[model samples]
Target: MRTLAATAAALTALLTVLAGTTGTAAAAGPTPLAPADLTGSVAVTGISLSWRQPAGGPAVASFRVYEGGAVVRRTATTSAPMQYLGVNTTHTYTVTAVSSNGVESPPSAPFTGTTWTLGMAPQCDEPAPLTVFDVTSSALSVRWSVGRASPQLALTVNGRDYGIVPGTSLRVGGLTPDTAYTIALRRANCDPRTAPVGYATTRTLPGATNATAAPRNLATTARTDRSVGLTWPAPSDGSYVHQYAVYDGAYRVATTWTPSATVTGLFHGTVHRFTVAALDVAGNESEHSPVLSLSTAACPVLPPSPSRVTATAVTASTLRLDWTLESTAGSYTVLDGDSAVATVTDPGAVLTGLAPASPHSLRVVGSLPGCPDTPASAPLTVTTLPGPTDRPVAPLGFRVAQPTVVNTYDADVPLSWTPLPGLAYRLYDGATVVGTYPGNAVTLRTRGAERHQYRLTAVNANGDESPPTAPVDVITPFLVAP
Candidate 1:
């Protein structure tokens, strides 16, 4: 019994020694070494693996490629090309060498390869070809092609299969406007377990109508002695209206891009009628809107006070004022802080030589020949924009320095930049001003693992701002380590 046990132990030791051999010997022909530098190149639906034979290895009889411990291919050469793989799939493989006596070496390191994704994957025919030829608000036309003739095929829309479609082309209707859809083509008797032969995605067009209807809510917005200001809503037919036509009875007086227009050069003490119509981008004209009728003021009538007064700063040292009157044939005066700054015959006046970054109160007064001047309109205060000259320059060398941890989820990010004399700074996160600092540095508190962009602008005493500096990005960590 002892002799028999010794013989079995010696046999196990011999097998262990053979298994541990790394070099291939010509005399004994032990198991060869694993192939080295095993690498893979992937195609649309395939992967090819290549390797170099290890040094000191015996002449290889064949090479085996293993996937998940199963031999998938055996090739006599150092390279193997595989086909018919799943699209956009990742596959891992290892290579091994086989000796002439049917001895297999250990597997090489794993190599991962991914097949081509959508867009690069081979389309229709081999995969099936589907095309969307026409798209409408509620319908679309689709055509498909196959390499071989099949008696019947199926059309699947959004996972619902319609069995046994007759031809390669189909007109699908009853779709919702501005909706997305997924379409596929398959064999009529295709197995539920397999993928479709062809698939595509598309969106239906939005609903629209012809702009042939008249505009609504026509009215007079302002009135003057010789002119009428009119306004109306655009046609509500989901069509783009690029221009409008103002009409006086049968005559076209003016064309404008806005919904409002003013007609001038009319006689005082006269009755006038005005109407508006909309024009689409395709130059299609809509029916005329309802008419608005009013009479202009006579010569001896007292001028009415200006209404709807508005003042806007056009530049650092200029402003524009507009107002409406019951009769516009009279003279008008614009007042700035109780001082007459302009006198004009029109409803709009531009005032120049004003101070930059300063606020002023404005109003308008109207008067006619042989009539008393009308009362001034309510005061409107407006501030001018920053001037072009003598403003601070943009910050120099702006950067986000190191961050100091505040807590588990918060940190204080330090920002530094070169300072300018007699100028304050405004720090902006995107378009929002986050802080105003008199010095060159500021610390901002942030939370989460988020990225933030910052820009710096210099502010002068008049509230004029310089051009913003280039933006810098900073990211904060989700957690702080002790």
Candidate 2:
């Protein structure tokens, strides 16, 4: 049934384009109104135009025959009951329904078509448009071209109306899985105002075919605060997947086939979700599988919090003190051993109202109800870390970012800092000098390591160091962008 309809559609088209040129006498308007009903049979093949009984029109000066939209020949009054069309080929033709007044009705509709021999040029209307990429899943993305000259071409896939774009791509997404599609193209010429002639067809890409590879089951396991483990069904199928995409919910997390993927620095007791997608040689990704979610145990208990954080001296009306909190106790609680202080939720506490050179003391402690309480923080007794005497100009231009940490993939790192000449950088690994370099900039490259402790100190060539700057905590994941 589909083939029959296609034949009719093709015939109606070829005939319309060729017939308007019939009879040498141009019609004043659109198609000749009477030709449509003329009784006759026409067949098209690349080589010949065959017709049965061409003698019924008025006065018949001649019978004009068309093949594939081109005039093939004109036969005089006496050619027999039927004319013999040339060799095997796909062509469509129509005959003129003429009037005795040397006028011809519009040519008859086109007929069944056949293909021509190899030596003959193709009757295709335009240069074959290139078909670009093809991707299949529920969504298919493909690009192709129709003639650049025609603005009215419409493309149909499996007889379904696909919206057209001047450029070649059709992102046919949200389609059924494992289905085949046929594409067709059509265009019309307006000067003559005719139906389209160009047509073509191609099928959707194959998915999970007997010749294609299938997914192998994968296994995942939790590792230390650093990584996770990944395993997969060996390539028993004899085909290798280029890479695997790990998923956490709808977002993809990683691409690898490694039996063990050590995921690092995840929040304690928090569950992480994961799944795997495979990449084929064609760069097509496989559908994600069932999810793999796991929660990590909390990091090893942290050392007990440091004792008493306090504001020792009130110099320049500024109070200062120091203390500690248990690192691993979910959180911390502190008391301002300095003032008639109440216990504070945060680790640091400050006090006011003091005379210059006067002294004061503070008491502090760290506690986690569920865990062991640390020894009471010792009394914090000391003068304030000196206040600035004058406006000490910054020797080098520097930037202090708010919460200065940048997130990369799964990690956070400190903002980069640059120094001016005559200025030296002192990078610390906890009060210990890791670097003392003379330069305007320091670029740190920490490959995939998610969490780290870092701090920097700027010193002038005079050897006087600036007050200790706030420490920066960086957390990040492996894998830099390409």
Top TM-score hit: 2
Clashes of 2: 38
Model 2 lDDT per residue over 1-482, tens place: 12455345433422111101134455343222333312222222122232222223333333455556664443322111222233342345576633334455566666544432223433335432534234454334433333224445555556766434333334433333467665555553433233334344444455542222434465665454224565666456566667655544333446666423455433233345555556655445554444456655534233234432434342322244444432323223334443443333334433322332333455555554444555555555543323233221333343333232233322223345656556676665332355766765455544233233455556554333444444555443333323
TM-score of each: 0.23, 0.28
For model 2, the run of ten residues with the poorest summed lDDT: 13-22
Model 1 ranges with Cα > 4 A deviation? 1-388, 480-482
lDDT of 1: 0.63
Runs of candidate 2 exceeding 4 Å displacement: 1-218, 235-239, 258-260, 265-267, 300-343, 347-380, 383-482
- TM-score of candidate 2 versus the correct structure, residues matched by position: 0.28
What lDDT score is found at residue 254 in candidate 1? 75
